[model samples]
Target: MATRLQSKWFRDNSRLQHCLVSDPHHVLRGATGEHVSLIQGALSILDGSRIADDEQKRHLYGPTTENAVLEYKKRRRIINLLYQTQADAIVGKMTIRRLDEEMKAQERSRSHLMFAVGVSLPEPRMVILSETANRDFVGWANQMVKLYSGKVVKVDAATDPAEEVKRIRQAVNTAGAGGLLILSVGHGVCIPQFGEQGTFDLAPNAAMRVLGKNYNENEPKDFVSPYYDDKPAANTGLKPLSQKDKDERDQTPGAQRRLKNWALWQEVCKIFVDGKLSAVVLLTCRIGGAPLFLQKIAGQWRTKMIAYKDQVGCYQTASGRFRTILGKDKDKTAPPPPPHTNTPWGEITIPLSMTDMVVIDPPAAPKTP
Candidate 1:
């Protein structure tokens, strides 16, 4: 197993000076003493009887050193193959430069640092009722946010969806771009528009309405009635509305309203269109499975999206799955778990291209020991 090291350790190349090839004349082949030892140590190839036979302290240009150099040359050839270039067995400035480049690449690959934004269904909308479930979801979301170095922006249920979107946009703008926006909502529904073939419409506050149905056995209650009946003309049961009454009713100011999914999608696109956001992950129930819906937004925004391809269960299940992906804490001694599984509860990545939706299936369950 490869031990993880700090980035600074690799960034500082001074430690490699002793092992680095200095003299142009002192090459690996037919080189005796410290030269052979230094080259072998630099490449981390400790596989020879001569290397273990340290009692003599004699660095002889033996078969062991030659074999190590040969192996190193072969590795370089493999790298050259990738670039469609001819490979030479000799090590020189070119080889040292490639090694340095590889170290820098390693440093980048090991960096888990990131910045992110987390958005979740607020208050009444997230009526899971179970405190444990809610806590687990919040914890899991926070864990992911921390893993990516993000901050959570709470959106209250009382706030209009449009206003929430505006706030999020402002936050992204203020934070200065190139991060993630993670949205955890309820079930996603597609409403068809009359003339729009690929576009889907949505009723105001659709997430609350749809999610409420899952939480309650009774009919989903509304924050306010869609119809307005507070006017004085209603006293006359069958009377026609006067122009003045109509104007007054139209002028009457009401509460701010939530936007439909299409409107929400538009708002999201506006924020991410300039490549400000590298990725978006919708942690909702069924949005991942909606290919048409996902394709419509992904195609327009050109941002990658990670979402579930099936109905993600309650917060508990969602959190559990996230923990599994991030790795379990208990049994750190055990081998690392596979990233993918065969379960229906897998994450799918919708790329910028409409045709290339990649599904990462879950790995099979481990057999009993």
Candidate 2:
């Protein structure tokens, strides 16, 4: 089951420059270093454009990387079955060796949808984050959009959410037909009351301007989502929120914003005139932990979701394998596979399509007129 991918980037074309470590030393998700680069490099050569960046030297295991791992494991049936029932997507002994097996040969090519669309609009007031401070994410998003979103449409996620929705609908219409894919980038947040309905912060700052600064900012709402399953899973330690818990979180800021985004998705969902958009990729962090939230949001968009369940960041050391300029990774060429999967925590989850979130270095941004 070796991947059909063929590339010279793979070391010697028979084996990776670095080996995928065994258990304990296994490279799970949330990892960053040279070892990760090795894994990403191999996958890139083995899987074609599937990795986020074809030459992902950043070496951070984000959603795209995690999904690739899951896909690789699934295709090769690398599950041990002794410990876990299904492919967990974590890069342990079995997973790595399986990926290694494909390093030696070349075969068919995998076709992917490079036409996904991305929509990101943070509060207009928020400054463009130091592009370097969040380079890993910025780069990931930039690359993912570039590689997968062959047809790019420009929309500001304008301060007026309603307008943003209108613009997105227009993008979908003009982008042509087929499975529609979208990337929602920016801050992701969760209210304990709706922990399972985790939402993003794309609301305009104008909505928050009138709210008092000293008021209870952590209070919860009575909000309930149709797709949210409050019942805890049979054995998962996770529990439902009590009234006290909800009260504590209701005062939080951004509730309206999250709600607005929720409504916005409803509108976005309705825009599926041709077919369900391939998937709504959430480039935000930690949303994957809330499966129910994903379900609800996806339901709103009438599509599946791909999201992460952790604080997505790559490491940067003065002498680290992945160096940074100012703060961004110095090397801007490369792609990655998807991630450390969901255990008590989570990896990027693709409810339907298990693997398709690779990220290669994106072409430079176009000059704005």
Candidate 3:
């Protein structure tokens, strides 16, 4: 688990030694890290700039950092309340204090962090959601990071899946007894049934590149932008995992513990946050394939959960409405079943929204005459 930025503040912080402040006791231009990096971090949180967290370059009060400081002060009206003046473009004492206070509150709220598939949703929009989900994830997050301008940690869970769990649990613990609506978008191995939801065998993730859009910090309008990173190739279809390698990894206890929900979300909910979440929608493949899986999960959670049992895709309409489409689903989509309380998988609900999303109290099957 990462230490909250506020925890990193306070007197005698070892990292604080990198940057220094003068008589006015504020961080300004030309000064580099004694705590300039930390100042940049706080400004990023306060103003939602894509400032690099803890990097050496972030230690300098560059033009971007200066602008962020100005924006943050303006937003908070961090004027010298005593003098009733306007905000300025400096990390003075008031700005630092305000940043610290804001970050403290931020760490205690619902926050977002993600790494996208590519930078943006691909063109034509016929591609499977797996290819585009991360793009949306990154896009939504980018928009959110700026709009809300909270403490957003930009990291790909692929490198440190455990870290994500820890971070989530910490955020949940600090959210002050409020329910969270969670939407997770990514690829998952389709589960045929409930008990067979093996996390490891299902753990392989689609290749993840750097922090997306070449680290584009700006929020997007329609989640559509040119890919600054390596664009995804056409659907060559997934290469099957070999049996021997799968067996070996599954046998390892440690590997099983680090299960990826791109198969089952239970590992994180049960182990980390203990159901602090209210609603969870996993936009992965074949989640609805096993009705019993969601049934078991719903019994545990207080709020609703939703998921798709089909290999989903994002389709953009001619009028520019981007939504999940039934046309793209080839095999993973389930067929509509007989009218009953127990919803059978297959037969998609038609023109679904956003990456064959699933989870929640699915509508009860209608009563047959």
The 0-to-1 C-alpha lDDT of every candidate, in the order given, reads: 0.36, 0.42, 0.39
lDDT of residue 29 for candidate 2: 78
Q: Tens digit of lDDT per residue, candidate 3, span 1-369?
A: 122224323323333322223325566666664366556544543454765333323346677777777877788787877766787786655665556566555434423111011111111111111122355444433433343433322223332344444544444443323233233335544345443241111111433211112222232211111122123454668644432235345745433332232122344435323534444445455655555445444544443555565554443323332334332433222232111111111111122322344445524435799
Scored by lDDT, the top model is 2
Question: Candidate 2: where is the Cα deviation over 4 Å?
Answer: 1-155, 174-180, 191-195, 202-265, 272-275, 313-369
What is the Cα-based lDDT of residue 78 in candidate 2?
A: 76
Candidate 3 has what TM-score? 0.32
Instruction: Kindly list the per-residue Cα lDDT of model 2 for residues 244-313, writing each as its tens digit.
Output: 3453466545555445444554565577434334444554445555565555555444555655554333
TM-score of 2: 0.41
Clash totals in order: 8, 42, 21
- lDDT tens digits by residue: candidate 1, 1-369: 122222322223332332344435424555444334334433441222233343112444455555555566566563445454654444444444444455445324432112111121121011101112245445554443444332334332213456555655654453344454445433343223311111111222342232211122122233211111223345656766643335344533321222233345456557756644545555444344444445445555565555543333322333243331211112322333221221111111111111122222223334799
| Cα-based TM-score, every candidate | 0.36, 0.41, 0.32
Off by over 4 Å in 3: 1-133, 144-158, 170-178, 183-185, 189-267, 270-275, 298-303, 314-369
Task: Give the candidate order by descending lDDT.
Answer: 2, 3, 1
